[model samples]
Target: MQPENVRQASYRGVEDPQRLYLAMLQDGEHDAREWLSTQLRRTASMADDLPDDPAQLESWAANHAAQVATDHTRYLTRRHQGAPRHYFANRAHALWFLQQVAPTKVVDGAWLHGVLRHWRDFRFHGLIRTFLEELGDGDPRCNHVLIYQRLLSRLGCDQGLPLDPSRYLQGVVQLALGRHAEHFLPEVIGYNLGYEQPPLHLLITTHELAELGIDAHYFQLHVTIDNAACGHARRALQSLRLLMPGQCAKAFYDRVRQGYRLNDLGIDTPSMIVSFDLEDELLAALQRKRPYGQFMHSDRCRLQGRTINQWLADAEAMPGFLRALEAQQWVRRGEAPSHSRFWTLIDGPQAAMFGVFTAYEKQLLHDWIVGDTAAEDCRRVRPGQWERDLALEQDAPVAQGEVCVDRMIERMWGNRHATPNGLRATRDFIHATGLTRAGPN
Candidate 1:
């Protein structure tokens, strides 16, 4: 189901990011000029920590790499000494992080959208290669977005959840940049440069996520492909140098700096990681489930002064109800979840409430119950643990509604994701996009 926020009208928040994202993916125009103008204005007063001279990009990248490498070494040393995870508190936190970042993840490589038309131009080759690679060069197995989608699917996060609109801000900016490339080329180059420089958090996140049993391949891919030595970071600098005009070079650099500052505008990875509160998320999950589960229970059991139904009826009293559960012997917090009577009903094969809560809800409850006592049971889904594209293997044409990626691919290039006639249609369409040296999409 589409999240309510996603289905809202355009211009919702910073001009409704979902609509703008959809418009571009559908091969249609949704003027993001006003949105970009507002963002550009926001960054005008922000600090530009990037080197002033574009010629210094190589050294700037090296400095960044050295710093990240040093920090990662320290992080590993701490981990070796048995420090708790620096990012994820538990497996559930890792899944939550993945789901929360879906908006930005799905729009990977959007900033370089405008440069696709210049595929044949050697000057634009760096940017174009980066963009194509983002699309996995049309390979389904390697497509960044699809890989994330599969991760969510395995973890039961594919179904929409109520997400903060602010989560979409960076994605909206990316799509907007793609649509407004003619006016934002320098900005795109600058933004790409900032994004391609692998931060220390990327390394830490990949390791921690893997420790928690989540496939960190997506992040691991970025760590390697976005390396400063000879990866997208290098390519970003090359594109900036190649595209900078001889006339009014200072003005161009000013714009690039402004664009680089644009990276600071959105809710960043650190903020997202710190924002998670397991208890708060559990409360939300309980509230969502309460609506339907309110009357499902028998009136046989009562906690404190209220019956189960009565407690469930009052949404505003959720916190109190949880406290009541803990106050009684019904739930024992800060222990193995299996020890709690409340967890008993929701767990096991023949438990009365076995089917009442979703796998995600069950996970939330488990983590909340475990609390500070969480042990080393970190693995969630092992890599390639589930089969992908079973229907395609069964010789079935993918259902139209289920083919979101293929639908967009078809709209843009009259080809589906998987190909017939021995042609990798998606790859050919994207690679062959630049009909001329610098043509339009």
Candidate 2:
């Protein structure tokens, strides 16, 4: 069989092979089943598949790398402890194992990670150094792995940025040095995954740093923001020791010095510290959709400092505005099914951030609220919507039609907007009241 076929077939065996193995151990004896339970309990910890140390992770990568082509049987045998090594000599043996029962099931992703880690550990010590000898210039696998590894190392490094060390040290000094193992990294770095967007590099500049007035409290937090774009960084985290700030609190400021920061976290510095403003660019984009100041109701914009809670709490006309704005643009001039009505909303400090929608759509939404045009186009597609439709029986219901937010979020990034969390809460509350069933997402 081809390699791909063998791999697929092996996976089926991997998922289910419990009964046959127990039978083999039992030899059809009644006592064997009881003995198997005890053995099973002993091996329960193996299910965790934790690395013995940093070296073990590397060894795992190397082992899998070697198995990529040669000795498929040995590869399968090595997966289980106490299982005879090299028991399977050919693809047929692997197939037999799959058909037979096994004591435990192997998780697919975890197994893959173990193999990849073995290869990486081998490469780290120059065992397979040829792949990454030149850095940024090598075979595809070598280059990809090397670059990612480098990026992770850079992100993890602590260079001692200009944070106050005294406060950070306070957290460590408070810890009991004798009884507790100190975990310094978690105290310094924070990991969060936002939607799949590129790093906000422009916002990282020191100029922006000046605008975020850094107080002592901020330093004490030792906040490190991780975007998770780099795989090596994620992998290296296997060795990370997590501890309270009471231990090694200084490590937090050290990370700050090394430029450990988050892209999404806003700066607290004074606004005057920023040399350039994005206001012009934002204004230009807004002008393209509507005449400047068309949406301006009063000199004082209602959106400033408003949380997402407040925005969604506005009159029922708000959702209408969203629906209208979403419909103005057609993918092609005259396509059948159009775009989504709910744009992604982001909550910024002063503004409710939403994305590219047309002026006509925005106006139509305002009109829908107070009786300009009855929204007749909204339709329900998923079962959730059907459930939601039924709930709104007391209120007048529209036809079974509305747009899905998935398409908007996935395709054009149309769903992103700057709505405050509070505003989002209010919107969610209102939405919950309607017939729509909550989505699985």
Per-model TM values vs. the true structure = 0.85, 0.17
- Error of model 1, residue 252, in angstroms: 1.3
| lDDT at position 92, candidate 1 | 75
lDDT of 1 by residue, 1-441 (tens): 011122212223366665655565565466778889888887776675577777787787888788889989999999999898998888778888888888888778777767755655778888877876776665566667767777788778888677776777778788778767788988998888888888887899899988877778888889998988888888888888899999999999999987876776656677678889998998998898888978877888888978889999998978988899999978898888878999998898899887887777788888888888657576655544342443222132233332443343433221123233112434444434532223388
Q: Per-residue error at 236 for model 2, in Å?
A: 6.9
Q: List candidate 2 segments past 4 Å from native.
A: 1-48, 52-59, 62-316, 322-441
For each candidate, C-alpha RMSD in Å? Answer: 7.1, 29.4
Write one digit per residue (lDDT tens) for candidate 2, span 1-441. Answer: 012111111112111223332332233121222322232233232222223342353454344334432443344455445443222222212212221211111110110111111222322221111111211111212122222222223222112112222212111111111011122222122211111111222122211212222111111111121112223223223323222134655554333212112211122121212211222222233334344334434435333344323434444334433333334431111122222222222212332444334322332222222231232222222211211222211232223222322221111110111112212322232233231222597
Worst-scoring 10-residue span by lDDT in model 1? 1-10
